[model samples]
Target: MLLSDLSLSRRLERAERDSNARFVEARAAVSPDVGAGWIDVGGTYAMFDGVESPCTQTFGFGLFTAPSSGDLDTIERFYAQRSAPVFHEVSPIADPAHLELLASRGYRPIEFTSVLYRSLDGDLAIAAPADSVARPFQGRVRIVDADEVERWAQTSAAGWSDVPGVGPFLVDLMRVAAVRPDARLFLAEIGGRAVAAGALTIDDGVALLAGASTIPDARHRGAQLALLSARLAYASQHGCDLAMMGALPGSGSQRNAERNGFRIAYTRTKWQLSAGTRA
Candidate 1:
């Protein structure tokens, strides 16, 4: 049983931070024009995928120790050098002093995420969709091979194309995710047609579950549940002890995670340097 304490925060924060670091590396490798990169400040990861990319942020701060005023200055300079806005995904369990420093730096809260976790024990359960499928079809999930990276990216992009904006950005990000080192892209199919896509990456015995999306047409099917079960099974087989993901508080994703036995580890805040203070 993992306690929701600093120890747990370290594992979860490290897992996510490393995942984004790998993503930045992958983006640079696949599309150098994007100028993707990252650096380690104190113990935090400062990543730059692009000026407008959500991957442009810092992670894992206050995990090993609190970030000093100088550390924040260095981090701000890292982003300033790239002409990008500064953002930090801060866990609630982070040292109080870190929050104080952020306040002093004129950062303001802009987003909230419910970080969730579930231990991977024996015989994991595969859930069925909340609503029965409109059409009867068998669901299957499998990890894509290297040759299918583009296919995986396309399927994942198709899943999010309906979002009001960020379609093009997500398309590129999905492409980068598909090729990240040590990352596994999974696809769910029904009647020989791919309907959903997701990604799994592990770091220090913890698995980060992300990029989950089902194409608009396949919404009522069991593709997501199948993908979730398959990813969990793979994580367990590969020696992961804990699995985690973040979702907007009170969103369908959070409810779905809760139904799958994941409990809220903490509510994290995404702090951004106020527009007036940006370099």
Candidate 2:
């Protein structure tokens, strides 16, 4: 019975912030030529993976500490120097003045994410998929061994192959993620063939679930549910008190999170600097 108050928001946001920062650190360690980097500003983490990498952004802004104008200036400069757009995933529980300041500086809301959480007070019962097609999932989930990093990354990228673009980028990104020290990569296999993948990162007693993907041929076969159950169990065994994730509002991911006992803690907005503002 955890309350969705500011304290909870801080824990959830910090868990995710630390996870993203770890990816940045891992990327830098694995490929320093890519210029992967991150900095902490007034309790906020500003990361720069690439000009177009989704990892390029800020987190925990105005949450741990009220962000001042000078703080914003430094964060903006950090990204500008890297030729990346400034983006901030802002939680609703953050200082209200933060939004006003962002808007005043020409930052516009570009995306929204429903942050969800569920307590891990005891052994979590694995929830069956809602649809009959995915019930009694016939797959098994297991953590990847050190030698299987490439296979894990390939399985993760295969899940996104249908997209018109971004396949190669995802392959590289997942490869880096597979080696992230803070992350545990899980693979769902049916008949001994990997079909799905997901990642879990625990920080300060909170587990952040992310990188969920199922190959096109593997959908509706219960792979995701198997992965979810495995990840949750792993988190609980690791002494995490809660698990959190984010999904687009009204999306199937959100529905799945809800079906698995997660509740919306807040809807966070991702603000991006307008082109004019950047100029």
Candidate 3:
């Protein structure tokens, strides 16, 4: 469905849920240094934990999976650690009561984002590169070897200001991509210089479009479009039916997703709790 055709609220809700599920699954599978816990209150469940990153640590509560208020105190104590945690909350859990409770306990909202999704069941037509641009680079992009994987990481770091741990994170992503041949990375280049990069991962019928970025000098040069087109084409060739991405709050990434035929699926909030405070 076209992003412009959906209701903002409906789109936000859908996007957020899909994004949260993807996070829970991906992080749980690959993150070995972090801790994960699920609180079950009758039939309902809430998953909360601390995810460690280099610059900032994240404490997330998957509202849909969260147990009950009666278990909140216990869960809180369990997650309180030495490091200051950034709390994350998604929609449906951002009710007034929950907000107030967070505020009363010193939790503050930091960032918000609208999730986006695209259907891959039908043909996706992307405009061809201009005559001046290289056509060989336009075809299905894939990271088939270790050298390309390292290059992808380096290009990603260069695009994102060399954020701490990014290199390691991309390396980890490549580790997964290596075993899964169906997973691929796309780079947009001109005259043999890599200007943009993105990746497509197909898992359990879901195609996640991730790590899309363009170097500062390459912005507005159609690099994003080229990377995205390559990813969609690769996905289509591999039988993926849906494309998903988690966009940061109020960023150009969100706008770009909209322009690329992605509709807002939902909004997700991040919650932080100390690991040491749980008792």
Candidate 4:
């Protein structure tokens, strides 16, 4: 019931479950260290950053309910009571009536995110363009720990430096993710210094490539490709049937993913709740 053709239903199932798992794992990530938690509002999962620090999705919801199900009022009350930045990811396969309902209820489109996926039947090679500008490093990547978590976080922050006020959040998320049983943080190191990083979460026969970043100093030397290859290998070994990731449409990230054999599953919208609108 998700995509126009039933041929994609299984893939959509993977994507939906992968997306749902994030909120669940994120809620668990904040449980012991921070008091924040996740709440299921009429089948939708909501996450709140527990420590309340400026870093981190700190608070938001995903895996939205169908508008035809008549849960609009419940969803509205859930966000109306939260008092934090409310966000929703509406998939391209989502019911247009549902989107209409959300828009009618004051949700405004803010951003576009493309979900890409690739089957994990092995054979994922790093994207190495002959005209690559960055220097090829003599370093290797591995699962990280110790001070490496901090380094991974710093690299991620640098990768996303263009975003204002994202450093702290990336740091906290990486720190927490490093300890999650479902999560694995991978780092590419050259000369014993962590340069590029990516995060993977495995659950229910699928792995989500949650985040990938490299510092400006290590942009082009195939760091992300390395991360992707490694993560895919690990996921396949760990029984992950499919691997998925999200990126900005028309961005370099999207191009990189496509070059690595990831197919476009869909483009989704991140909708924000407009001010002064009643549920």
Question: Candidate 1 — which residues are off by over 4 angstroms?
Answer: 129-137
State which candidate, 2 or 4, has the greater lDDT.
2
RMSD of each: 1.8, 1.3, 5.9, 4.1
lDDT of 3 by residue, 1-279 (tens): 444332433333433334334444444466645544344333223344344532232223333343335545544543454233544454533334666665555556666767677887766855433433434343334443545766775666567755665656655544433333444667777767887777766764457777677778866666777778778877777776777777885677777677667777667566555343333
Candidate 3 versus the native: TM-score?
0.64
Q: Give lDDT tens digits, candidate 1, residues 1-279.
A: 778999899889999999999989998998899898998988889999999899999998777777787788888898888899999999989887878888878998999999999999865885554755434336789999889988888899899878888677778888889888789999999877889999999999899999999999888767888889899999999999899999999998898888888999999999999977853
| Better model by TM-score: candidate 3 vs candidate 4 | 4
lDDT of 2 at 176: 90
Worst 10 residues of 2 by lDDT: 126-135
Among all windows of 10 consecutive residues in model 1, the one with the lowest summed lDDT is 128-137
If the candidates were sorted by their TM-score against the true structure, best first, what order would they fall in?
2, 1, 4, 3
Report residue 163 deviation for candidate 2 (angstroms): 1.4
Q: How far in Å is the alpha carbon of 107 misplaced in model 2?
A: 0.4
Question: How accurate locally is residue 91 in candidate 2, as Cα lDDT from 0 to 100?
Answer: 95
The TM-score measured for candidate 1 stands at 0.95
Cα lDDT tens digits, model 4, 1-279, are: 123232353455444544544544664655555444555554444445542432212112323444543454655564456555556665656556767767777878888878787788857666665457644446897987765666666776678777788877767666666656667888888788777888887757778897688888777777877788889999999998777888889888788778887888877777766877755
lDDT of 2 by residue, 90-136 (tens): 99999999988998889999999999999988657766646645467
Reference-based lDDT, residue 67, model 3: 37
Q: Best-fitting candidate, measured by TM-score?
A: 2
